[model samples]
Target: MFTPILAISASLNDSQRIHALKVGANDFINKPFIEAELAARIKNMLLTQQLYQQIAMQKEALEKMAMTDQLTGLYNRHFLMPYVEKALSSAQRYNYPLSIVMIDLDKFKLINDDLGHDAGDKLLCGIAHILENNCRSEDAAIRLGGDEFLVVLPHCSLEQAKFKTETLRQAITELPPASHKTSASFGLSSTEEGNFIFEQLFSMADSAAYQAKMNGGNDICH
Candidate 1:
């Protein structure tokens, strides 16, 4: 992708020189050129190329920072909608199951109230790591604001989602004790028909998660 091409050619018309530059010629040298001038042109081109590459890398890093959650290093809620919409459209068109798991930390407020926000933040970050480590590479682990997270599992069924949630729940329980013990509740929802919209999918998962919280603090509902 990064080919450093320096084209040395004989004399060219104005239009031809413009075309060469447009098509990515690093430097074009005319015949009977002075050695010093040619060397200077090549050096300038190399410096320009380096500047361009560094600017490109900086731009890429800035974009990634914008899309990521600073606390957990996971994709933030802002990045989830567009990605989920695209995935849902594909699953619906192909008739494949797509599941969304909604998770909430149990008694998260109590931890903040008792210990401090720093402790609560650490617990949230720990939970984010568990979610990231447990899910497949293709899945998206998203932090949906404080204490709430969502995992989008493409081509996964309700049963599979249940299994995954259980695994995560167990992992949360096993974390070393902090200021306060941490547990999580999960709600799993899947698309069966081809017409379920993204909002409906979210609603199903959100409702289930609320039910899990009502029943107890650490459980899963679907």
Candidate 2:
């Protein structure tokens, strides 16, 4: 609801009042009405508008909380699948490539063990900031729980994804070093076909990420 609407007219017939009410009039005033009454109604309408704006802002904040990671302030796993599906559908419909990149911190457990959980969290948040800065407005950065992250690139090719992940890898290396040092591995997969399955793309990326880790981390595999 927005500002409360008012109907000011000389008509006082029952039908006229009913019509006003049905048309969403919150208050009605007749011609030659008392100035005090008009002023009071105006004040009430202004108050109602303020309340409506407050409620709208609260609702927006709640929705953002539901979709975002509390620690990194990035999109959480809950937002990934749905958002990817929508982006993928649009990409497929338009015959454009869509890519997914899987990222995992290398030797992350050592950070928590040697330093502290708080330090580990700080590192993650720092990396999240890099991702947010590197990605375009059309891209999404997701915290897929723990030290795992995902990046969805709409209308981006596999090669483009590789370049982006390489950039991110370089950025990660610039983060303050942990006692055991900090690094990450990346994997990418892309499709231009409308019939491609989301799970298949994700699995490909995951496997490639695993390969990168096995090959001694700090690199991208596709």
Candidate 3:
């Protein structure tokens, strides 16, 4: 929602905007408004409205395209980095704690092979739903393609992260989709890797993800 913007005429030989600002206007335009000036102001207002509208639309769109997994409607890796980077920076700056949990489907290959891709897709979507519902609104779950999902907890400890992951695991199992046939493994890391370049941060989290997959598929390894 764009804040209301105001514009006034400069008839008093002063940029009435200064006074108008005090009169409940967010941003103001000057006086002695010529037709062109009026046109420009109105144009600007309309343009601003349009610009703001475009910005709003873009924001909504970006939220969907950048964050959401197209198929599962879960947050995607593209959005994860920016969100995590910001969280990491803020956490470090404020002496707060931040952690990441990477999840991967266990026996995924067998499931895809036996159930077919459609079923596999359904499982992925179901998994995403379970993870999202199991998390706090502030917490985010993202898909890094395939059967992998990463959850970033900005102010959470390893214990909180573990509890959350367990919640998701239980949810996925307890409320399995129609076939009742998918399971996941998780790996968590909460060590403070300070001032990492973006790529390094991702690489670190990614390495943790790989570890989750390799060391016995269904438990959290931090």
TM-score of each: 0.90, 0.95, 0.69
Q: Over the stretch 1-222, how does candidate 3's per-residue lDDT look in tens digits?
A: 665666555553444656677766655555444577656666666767778889889889986786778999888877877787887788887887777877778888787787798878988888887877777877888888998888878788878877887887777765444554556777777746453344564556567657766876566666
RMSD of each: 2.1, 1.4, 5.9
User: Which residue ranges in model 1 land beyond 4 Å of their true spot?
Assistant: 1-7, 13-27
After TM-score superposition, the amount by which residue 115's alpha carbon in candidate 1 deviates from its true location, in angstroms, is 1.1
Reference-based lDDT, residue 42, model 1: 77
What local lDDT does model 1 show for residue 181? Answer: 68
Model 2 Cα lDDT, one tens digit per residue, 136-166? 9999999999999999998798888888888
Off-target runs (Cα >4 Å) in candidate 3 are: 1-59, 175-181, 192-215
TM-score of 2: 0.95
| Global local distance difference test of model 1 | 0.86
Q: Give the TM-score of candidate 3.
A: 0.69
Q: Which candidate achieves the best TM-score against the true structure?
A: 2
Clashes of 3: 5
Clash-forming residue pairs, model 2: none
What is candidate 3's CA lDDT for residue 141? 83
**Number of clashing pairs, model 1?**
0
